[model samples]
Target: MLDTVGLTVAEGEVYRLLLVTESASAEEISGSCELDTAAARRLLLALEAKGLAYPVEDSPGWFAAIPPEVALVPRLQRQSEALEQTRAAVLEMVQTYQRGARARVGGEAIEIISGAAALRQRLRQLQDGSRREMLWFCKAGYVAMPPESNQEQFAAHDRGVLYRVLYEQAYFDDPGSVDNVVEGVRAGEAARAVPRLPLRMAVSDRSVAVLPLASPGAPGSPRELKAALVRESSLLEGLIDLFERYWEVGAPLRVTEEGRIGGAGPEDAASLVPEDRHLLSLMVAGLTDEAIAGQLRVSKRTVQRRVQGLMSLAGVATRMQLGWHAARRNWL
Candidate 1:
């Protein structure tokens, strides 16, 4: 550790030997300090350069150590001064790097959000900070999240913050899915449905967008969670435009006290639209309301209402009876 004083090992040993022996020839320093004569001479030269040792006028190769207060203290002071200069240089470089980072706008417009918990936290933060509209596009994918997430959206919807959501037909396959859509509609959410949605994305107030990372097949699974956060930029605007284009074609839906609500029309269960029929197939396959809602990216309430509509048309009080009646009537 004492080597920080700028003394080489041999030089320190030779200096210490000189302090004990008072005066010594290179040979004496080598023998006393367990160093070779040439190494001893080199060590003395290094000490002399640091003003720690001085050569004898009468003895050409002999040396003496200066007192510690006069020699060691001065060398340590010089090292400390050099260290201070190094520290100042490093601080200046850090400041320069940070300034450059600030000057470059859009350099970090997109950030990768990894881990399930972290993505949830950031999503909630973005949602809470939203002051205007929220746009969502959802589809079948691998992800596990809190079931109560939609409750938060209800509060946002109540505050005059518009919510527009697009979902896949697969969403309505579950029981109770219709109730969520019904409640959301009651709370001022403009909900829509389509056969399928491409990605899962959430845009908050036209200011930020969050989406899962693009994957070859499924977006991601809970065990290997990954997502992205994007700030306002050319890319963000493009995403906004994409949402609008889909919104244009999405079938608008609302809940009414009566069995009838507007979107696509068909008179009976046997004459249900292809999308509604697909939902019936999922229900007949026995997926639960929550699972169907997750797969279709719709609310559990929405799914339930659709099943109720089917049951009403089939004149079946039970889901099992509706499934049997749909089959007998050749309803796909």
Candidate 2:
């Protein structure tokens, strides 16, 4: 099939199974082809639509396969026509956009782009063109701040782009933070950490904001950090509002006592004179004993002892119960 009609391996397997099985239902084909039933059904429908498979009208959910030689010609012809139609539609869209862009950019303009290299080039242009600051809130472990050395970040920083980044607390513990710090120091970028962030984001000078799309490989792949950028100031303002809210609650990124990035807050340290209220606050914030120790530069045993003392003070058997009691009393 690959040599004759360029069918993919999975497609060929499904086609062969249908051909050999006479008249099989989607479930049967799925079982024979080692695919999910729904997925098999979709493929079978596609094959039928392309004339490679014909539905058996008398049989409730059965399909008959057409021989490859008989099926390939019509299928390929249909595909070719579909591709030509798509190409024309795309070309018309490009022309329409170009005209709109030209009219809008009479002096300065915004451009929409697709494809990897084009997107990268646009990002580089934006970063290079930025005069003031670049602000970002990123997922804990995913985005390697400053990306690679030779990437757009370093180049933008070289051109004097001040960067302020907020990261999730977990990211500090990730191996990627080392690269983050190395590139950050080299680029003179400032960064902070928060325990958790709502979503991934990047904004530049209130002129452009990038937000992640939820779909897989949406704007692009997660590793690619694909995002949609809006140049509209009103929309950018809304994004900035959200960014500031998360920034206010986020922690500063610091090397922990354990020599890792990020830890609990200062109020969580057992070495500090324990204020029952402060300890309760830390607990409510979800800091573990180890995190508390790292934050306070105390032994984890000390944190455990303090927690136990606090638990006994509250007359609670479990932390959740203790937290509930505290919350009920408005302690946190």
Candidate 3:
């Protein structure tokens, strides 16, 4: 609309009239519009000032519109440029304000989100805003979101968000939890496992962190569940550091070609098939033979037989010696 170029509604009508005619006098403008002659003349002068209209060469009181390409286009371009500049400036100011606000209320930076629903919602929000990476400490027990149920992590990972997840050994005790880990790894998540974790936490891009205020498995109703949403604070940095420290000591997890859990092993174990690697990884993670059999859907005897075979292949006389051989030989 001509209003964007600084024309009033009546002045825009006058401009359009001039555009469609060779030239128009104030009387012609007033007859074609709601404005009177004096008002129409004033509008025409205003348009002239904006370089959208000019006096006809041989006529004293007639005006014609400047070619639209010569007038409106440049004005529109200038307006667009100004708007972009203003937007950038406003964004800068907003960032400055957020920084200062966080500084002024350091104690308020950690928000205590209550209830299972609120915790789940906050976790999703943090994942959605993650840009570079997401770090997680996955402990055992059902929380607001179980690992298999966290679809947001997959969505973020698919969009190139790096996911570094550390899982406690008990996490795999959950039925289908290993398969879920395998699925995540195949989908580009970098996963590892330790015997235990201190707590459950998720950090987004290292800028914000969310951790449970109480143990998830504590006997309590959903309404009693609580978590802390920490932002840009020393506490957040410490949480990130904790995650990294655990990740360094954790055994890397992998998936077999058959879509089962596997693990890193020495080059000597490369000759072992996917199933063997899968078995070794679970064993190294401290899963009992019964637990390993359940995960692989095999009998406990079958698991023992496989262990015996691995030990025989390593020429070891005992399980402890086999573990040593597996590590020294990089067979598991």
Summed backbone clashes in each candidate are 17, 0, 1
Q: Lowest-scoring 10 consecutive residues by lDDT in candidate 2? A: 102-111
Estimate the TM-score of every prediction. Answer: 0.46, 0.44, 0.62
lDDT of 1 by residue, 22-106 (tens): 8888898777756788988888888888888999999898888898899778878998899999999999997885566323337
Per-residue error for 294 in candidate 2, Å, reads: 9.4
TM-score (C-alpha, index-matched) for candidate 2: 0.44
Candidate 3 lDDT, 1-332, residue by residue in tens:
66788888877888889989868999998998788899999999998998989999899999988988998888889999999999999999978866663323466667677889889998998999998999988877767987777899889987899999988878777777777888889989988777789989999999989888777568899988878888888888888889988886676776767776665544645567757767877875557799889878999999999999988887889865665455456655
Count of clashing pairs, candidate 3: 1
What does the lDDT read for residue 71 in candidate 1? Answer: 76
CA lDDT scores, all candidates in order: 0.71, 0.63, 0.81
TM-score of 1: 0.46
Error at 136, model 1, angstroms: 0.5
Give the alpha carbon lDDT tens digit for every residue of 140-178 in model 2: 444323344336667678778888877664554544454
lDDT of 3: 0.81
Could you tell me how far off, in angstroms, the CA of residue 313 lies in candidate 3 after the best superposition? 9.0
lDDT minimum window of 10 residues, candidate 1? 259-268
Clash list (residue pairs), candidate 3: 266-330
